[model samples]
Target: MSESFNQEQNPSEEKFTSSFPPKPIVEEKSQNALRRSLISLAIYALMFYFLFDRNIVYIAAILLVLIIHEMGHFLFMKLFNYSNVKIFIIPLLGAFTSGKKQQVSQWQLSLIILAGPLPGIIIGCLLFWLNKDLKNETIEMLYSSFLVINLLNCLPFFPLDGGRLIETLFFKENYIIRLVFGIISIIVLLFLFAYLNPILLIVPVIIGLELYNENKHQKIREYLKHEKINYHVDYVNLPDKDYWLIRDCLIFSFPKKYNLLTPGKYEYAIVEPIVIQQINAVLQVNLNPDLNLFKRVLMVLFYIGIFVGPILLFLLNR
Candidate 1:
């Protein structure tokens, strides 16, 4: 994806920025923040020890690979001028990079998703090649683990790098489609674990928890949609990719728009018409509703290949 943004500013940018009310700021004590950080580090260290059976070398190698993977994501986010870029390590599962994006294109999103895994995959390949001659058990183990971790991270499951790519490429504007895919992904993972490694049921359990959280948030949005109140319309110039995020924020944070001047006693609306109109204009500029059948088929095949290819190779080698 092209990294460059259009230099020309929209004429409405000033008007848009001026219309919205300022967001409230929350203050936090530095000491409190420092204490929380220390606690989190302690927990992470304990988890790392338990996870790797106190193998210092293994822990160091794993952390290195994970940091590289996250750096790939962070770099791209920085390139795109995303705010508050940070990587959080989830003791057992993996690391995730998050940032605040005002707007992003689909291709830009794809680049970010691939960034999280591609660098690690490349480094893993290089390590595997270098260790091919020496055949040192530790180096070989690290090489294999690196490759396997990255490949697995590309699976078509929610909260994974591959799943994020799939969502951007295929489910772009449709919340329902993404939700349904998330559910199906959980089911597929459950069956795969049952057949291959029941001990890995934790994978699906984590995904299930993610889905539950999303559902809970969705319910809150639904409630907000029906609440009776009025809101002044604020125009913001946003890209097509950001429409959904902004819409979701509006759904959860504000009451239904009633009237321009006063709160309508009975009328209810999810958002003001002007807001929808602006969003639609942005959508019209970039929306591609249909993914071709051939590409869709290829994506499905790619998903299957990533999930099954490694297992087949391992068995064949054995």
Candidate 2:
């Protein structure tokens, strides 16, 4: 934690800038490799203290798997020009890299998202292939953990790599398609929760609930489509002031014929039916103001887990 803080504070840290979005933010620079070294040393010291000193080798193996998995996303995201990357190892849940929220095409997003779990699966397979004998317990355990974690990450649930793939690859332009996806995800999770451990159950429940709540607004949105665009949300209310509404949106509009939008596609039109000589257009939307309390609550809980729940898990599982 100290090292993480120092990385943020280090004045000489490398920075990347961008101009497409006006504010060129740091794209993806690891602050002082020395800070990372210190953090790794600290984590090792702590893990060694807790997981039996002799288990240091196993812990290190786990860290290696995690780093490779996260680097998959980090590397690919950089290749695609996602700036200001911050890769952090999150215990229990694995790792992730966050960067500038760039507007991406569906294909690009799919590739970026698929990059994370593919590497994990590849590495797990490689490990299994290398030790077909499976005589060493440490290698066996590592192999199993990697396979389990990677497979679980493969499940389609948002914010998860698989979910991102679905959003990017199989994404449909219609609200009905997304609604179907949400419903199917819930049904699959119901059966999954029944067969899985309680600890794993929470993950799907949280994700499913979020999907359901988000989809609940779909009906209202569809109903409003027949009407002219009159709805809009004040950006000031957003946690991130620059946030834009995704799915079932109207990017731009004209008086009689509003241009409709789908998840990752754009729809644009000239305001006049015979505007061969002149053009003037504006975007209008009937923003649904209804908040999904359940999703909001679950999101808060998920964030709490990200920050504090892992520490509790370490203690309980220790």
What's the residue-level lDDT of 301 in candidate 1?
A: 72
Off by over 4 Å in 1: 1-23, 26-42, 51-54, 191-203, 219-318
Instruction: Name the weakest run of 10 consecutive residues (lDDT summed) in model 2.
Output: 276-285
lDDT of 1 by residue, 27-69 (tens): 3354664465456545666787986576777777777778788
Largest TM-score belongs to which candidate?
A: 1
The number of clashing residue pairs in model 2 is 9
Q: Residue 93 CA error for candidate 2 (Å)?
A: 3.5
Candidate 2: segments with Cα more than 4 A from true spot:
1-59, 88-91, 156-159, 212-318
- TM-scores, in order shown? 0.61, 0.49
